[model samples]
Target: MSDTAAERAYRNCVRNLLAQFIHAVQQQPPFILDECDEESLHYLEQLESLPGTTGNEYAELGQAVVCRTIAAFPHLVPLLPRDLLWHFGGDCLHYMPDDEIDKFQQLDERLHQAIGEARPFDYERERAAIFGLH
Candidate 1:
């Protein structure tokens, strides 16, 4: 089946967030390594090896990374991009409040509508506007 607008948006979001997550991890101090449990470390290793991964693989790994962080290294959860949580949408959604989820749902609907109408849609700009980000 052809991908929907929401699916395309999710894949793009996951890919971008994975890169952002990797960059954020690289900037962390060596001491942070001491904080990761075996599972978290394993997920980090897999995440580092994500170059050339397919969209489905990126989604799975992104979900794993987010869930593992919430479970093992809660303090570092802030390092993850919030959009990743909403894009993957499973246990990840549990991390978001209802109001935040509603905003994301609206964003997805807007993306779908814009794409359907052949209008230009900028995901980041729309997201920032919805979330009231400057």
Candidate 2:
């Protein structure tokens, strides 16, 4: 296959795989990635880049990341690169309901560390950890 075609095919596969994983866990999705506005994307990007370990920064980034990741769960429909997908999903725990948030964290232990830490995140490392679950 040509590079473009191969890439397209791969994305489709990733989308299906991740979407299935999300479905299995039964968490509420935060948003449709494709339908998200630039404003939303910008917010997510900022959350991803936010420095960890400050007052409330860890929780803030974790909620932002998890909610966006789940809300934008369908981003997998486009098979976005793992790093990009995970990057947009960064943030703390306030946006989602409390009951669901704990389950979400329980679904992925690394998610807990990523959000709990008080330092800058490592997306590549996050990807390596979660891709195993997918």
Candidate 3:
């Protein structure tokens, strides 16, 4: 099946977030890499080498790194972008409660609607509103 508009938007968000993350790690490699397991490092290496690739190309590897980071270094969880968990879905969902998932789904729907209408959509602001953050 073809991807829906929402799916495309979600993929774009994930790709942008993942790229930002990779850039951050590249900037301060040792700080993050010293704690990563061999598998995570390998995935990061693969992802880092393919700069500017589409989300589909590196998303699974990005997901692997995110999942491994959560499992191997729980303390780093806060450092990792929270939106990535919702955008990546699959194994990443294991870390989020059902309520949080619902909120993310709602946020995505709102984002899609905004896009469909050509209205401005501030993702972080919308997300904070949905999550009841100040």
Candidate 4:
């Protein structure tokens, strides 16, 4: 191929890759990690380790699952990447700005409820909204 054609092809490949990555990342895939199992959860609950709140499993989890799970469990907070935590942080690490605090609290509550009830939610739009990608 000509140099111009080769350059165009390479650029197209990069664009295609970027589109795919964005699509996958925006989908807010489930967080049913291999380690978080029902058997273990039951054992933890029996041991009074898992707080009895929602009494639900984290199956088909939503985008907020990561944050909400960490909140519900608290122990997982340290496991999360600092950047991901910052991505959701508006000002302080745990609080949003004054004007948006209400909305932030509302969202937090929703995540808590979802995590408690193990509700399945497609957070593609939510993720996109966070990054202002779409």
Q: What is the lDDT of residue 132 in candidate 3?
A: 99
- Per-model TM against the reference: 0.77, 0.27, 0.69, 0.25
lDDT by residue (tens digit), candidate 1, 18-125: 788877876664326667566556766876877566678867876776787778666667888888788778789999999999999999898888767766677888
Error of 1 at 5 (Å): 10
Instruction: Give lDDT per model, in order.
Output: 0.75, 0.44, 0.71, 0.39
lDDT score for residue 10 of model 3:
56
Model 3, span 1-134: residue lDDT tens = 13655556555676677678767655554446557567657756765654455467656765676787777656556667889887667799999999989999999899878767766667767778999997
| Candidate 1 similarity to native, TM-score | 0.77
Candidate 3 pairs with clashing backbones:
none
Error of 3 at 131 (Å): 1.1
Order the candidates by lDDT, highest first — what do you get? 1, 3, 2, 4
> Residue 1, candidate 2: how far off, in angstroms?
52
Clashes of 4: 0
The runs of at least 3 residues in candidate 4 whose Cα sits more than 4 Å from the true structure, single-residue gaps closed, are 1-96, 124-134
Candidate 3 ranges beyond 4 A from true positions: 1-40, 46-51
Best by TM-score: 1
Candidate No. with top lDDT: 1
Residues 4-121 of candidate 4: C-alpha lDDT, one tens digit per residue: 4333443344344434433433333232354666644543333232122221332112124434535464554444433333323532345234434554445445445555555543
- Tens-digit lDDT track of model 2 for 1-134: 22343334433553454445445333322334456567656654554354333446744654455565546554533332333233234343334456545444443454444445533344334444544543
- Which regions of candidate 2 fall more than 4 Å away from where they truly are? 1-37, 76-134
